[model samples]
Target chain A: MSDIRFQCIKVEQLDDIHVVRFADDKVMDPARIEQLGGELQRLSDSSESPKVIINFSDVKFFSSAAINKLIVLEKRVRAKGGRMRLTNLRPEVRDLFGFTQLDSLFSIHDQQSDAVVELTTK
Target chain B: MPADADWIWKIDQEIPSRAEVACGLIRDFVEKLEDAGWNEALVFAIHMALEESIMNAIKHGNANDESKLVRIVAGFTASLFQATVTDEGEGFNPADVADPTLDENLEITSGRGVMLIRQFMDDVEYSQGGRKILMRKHRG
Candidate 1:
């Protein structure tokens, strides 16, 4: 009854990269993280091994659970010789990454195009 | 700091459905505290503590069984907010939980909740039964 729905996850193939954009409230809710993990796992299982771009512009709050799930997704992507990038992070959420010292662990970009450029160049 | 600002509430645990209702009640309580001029950090700390305690009661104490009961008690003073979550299940050994900070466990998913609670709360105390946790946070 909470009406807690996750943003739509759109997977678009940009050449060899997969751009996964979350289009809903980016709050850290356990149920939403589980669903996101499921989707990421499905994509990772495929043989294409595309670069992953997680667009976080729509997310406002960051939770430890969501961060943990992101770490899992990062590991999965790395295992397949692919890289994970985050883009369009709000300042508050970005501060969370900084607080957690995860800024060094993942590639972050101010714009989606910048993330795309980084992935293409790599 | 106003006098007579302290408040307390207690409820028994049920299924996640009932647990959610408890969460709602706690959320309302926190909102009321915020309206009373409690700082943001204390409010956030209370919210986190409440969520963690309720989840532990529902998942670990009741083992997700609807029949089991979990109890939560919360109190706030002018300088500190305290909460206790107790479950009906046979308690767990806190020492048995692996150190989540170790490099080997960094990628592991499950053990981080307790670590987060410890980090976020100013004080954390566990009873031998392993079913009860008392957490507190102070206002800055």
Candidate 2:
């Protein structure tokens, strides 16, 4: 586990892949979302070639602002030659990704194990 | 575009340009939709659309100015949902928004709200120089 603590996310290290899970079931609050985004960005910035996997198993709902934050996080990770993936999206949340065409923009997996395998093999 | 009487439930209020207050209003509406027997998927779609619309009004349209207010008018029936959100700020041009789905814009953090609203809602129209947005969804 990483020493960094985040109010909105819980991070666990699996070799080089950091699997992150959100603390809130609803990622709709703007202030919290901003804080969450800041934390994720910091994680990406502080790490060397970070490999991240965001697990959405607990998140029931989120707004576009949250999606915006994820996009920003993705870019930040990629800019540093890191990789980020998402997993365990509920059908509704996955539909939002499809609606925004973001499903194509990010590497998404059905399970954390799958993402771990993909990231580890890459 | 049916008569106002067609709606079984309606809400009209001017709220402060605050995210919490706006989201609270959306939650109330979602609860109402649930009480009215809208299925989970439809409720989720409506909730997402309302969330984006109101947030855009408060964050972008009103610029989070406490003095500015966001006007929301929403009506719903078992089969239909309709809403109009207007903000007290200089309106923007929706057409000028870059397509977030485009390769170059995909990394951009903003500008996806409008597209999501349009995607989830069956019908959406912008007027009053983009200060006001009208959205409608039909339960399927």
Candidate 3:
């Protein structure tokens, strides 16, 4: 068990939405990404399928594996008629999305409140 | 020469957590260099190089088999930092990778690792049937 401590998940409720904040320095590892996917799937399986707001405030690195997992999460959320919004992207992390041209594919915001509002509006 | 300046670590590729373990080792190396007042650009470059090389070993070389071994070697001198990653799997041709910026390949999900590695490193080279990569960055 490595001592790399990551605040991996934070589930908060704002009205009907579920804000799942993944605060971590290294969110790109395959194991951690898969664990996140499993958690998201479990959350989506519940009777209350609330809109999701993903906070990326603390994430500084982005890996293709992590992006793939998020794409899967997005598809799952949309299949349930809910949406996922990302927030608080650091510049370097944001550049990864831009490099893949996925910046347009995801709904991103500079602020958590903004992302929460956008998710609820949809 | 500072103590622990020539840190080198080698591990088998069969470990399921090799990537994380390798990254941790490189991070410690970079931190030590940074503490020695190494240039920030050099540190960032080396960090990206280490990441891409390790990822290639994990994803491409080992094919995520968890049965193969990926060996990493890292060294630093007063002027330059160099690292090498070698995998146990059969090597693939690096020339076969297509340009991700091409119009038809724009939507592809893969092929970004090598490109990023080349972009960030001062020098990048492959060897031994494409199973090994040597990357270096110089302090400015």
Candidate 4:
């Protein structure tokens, strides 16, 4: 029912938890990141759903600008009294987070189903 | 430092310091690296490092001035990948960037591009008075 159109992300909802799938397998610059930031901002402002899940199964390469958008989105969701989790990270993406030590900051799950189950259960 | 590459394709091109142009160049560069036989992870590393360096060249270095230019040069061999990005602006000292691991800078995302580039690439060097950046990654 959402009229919102995101250039880089597909949105779906399960109960109160909103799931977002990144459309591109690789992003080389900030254009997609900026678009994603706008979409995530809209999601945060929506009263329909609070909990969030981000699925990254299709994404492989990204810049820190994308990660910056993620941090901003995380803060926005927290400010809106909800939480977010990341799922389906490729090994390289996982290693990127490990190198940055951001793996300690966000809740990461192995698969989209697992993330949904956990977020919906909690 | 790059070893003697078996086959190297060099790109000496200039962009008008536009973000969209930069993105297109990055994508083309990524495809070129893949065609050079780099595995996914190594290509990803190169892609990440390239984006940071080129973005810095366009954004921070050129101050987003369309009149400025960003130059990119990159090539790869079977085992090694090397790239350089140069900008037309006053360069800043890389040493001035705070350690993102520090408590105060951990949440600040803007400063982490340089750090991430350093983290993913095997060797990263800044020269040309810091307006130019060189990044290399070795494949296993």
Question: Each predicted complex: what DockQ?
Answer: 0.26, 0.74, 0.18, 0.74
TM-score of chain B of each: 0.81, 0.95, 0.81, 0.90
Worst 10-residue lDDT window for candidate 3 chain A reads A1-10
Tens-digit lDDT track for model 1 on A21-108?
7745534345666677776677766645658888887775455666777888888888888888999987666755664456777789
Task: Please identify model 3 stretches exceeding 4 Å from their true place.
Answer: A1-7, A47-50, B1-17, B33-45, B64-67, B76-80, B98-111, B138-140
lDDT (10s digit) by residue, model 4, range A1-122: 38777777888978788888888777555766787788888877875447889888888886788888888888788777788999999999988777777777778998989888887777
Q: What share of the true interface contacts does each candidate keep?
A: 0.05, 0.78, 0.05, 0.73
Tens digits of per-residue lDDT for model 1, B17-120: 25446546666767777776876555655665676667666766777777777776666766667777888888888789897666566666665557667766
Instruction: Please report the candidate that would top lDDT against the real structure.
Output: 2
**TM-scores for the candidates:** 0.73, 0.92, 0.74, 0.93
Q: How accurate is candidate 3 locally (lDDT)?
A: 0.70
lDDT of 2 by residue, A22-95 (tens): 99987888999989989988888768788999999998788888988898888888988999999999898999
Q: What CAPRI grade goes to candidate 1?
A: acceptable
The interface root-mean-square deviation of each model, in the order shown, is 3.4, 1.1, 3.0, 1.3
RMSD to true structure for each model, in Å: 5.3, 1.9, 5.7, 2.0
Clashes of each: 2, 0, 3, 0
| lDDT, candidate 2, B1-140, per-residue tens | 66877888899999999988987888888889989899877888888888888898988888999899999999797678999999988999998999988878777788888988888899999999999999999987
Name model 2 segments beyond 4 Å from true: B1-8
Each prediction's Cα lDDT score?
Answer: 0.69, 0.88, 0.70, 0.83
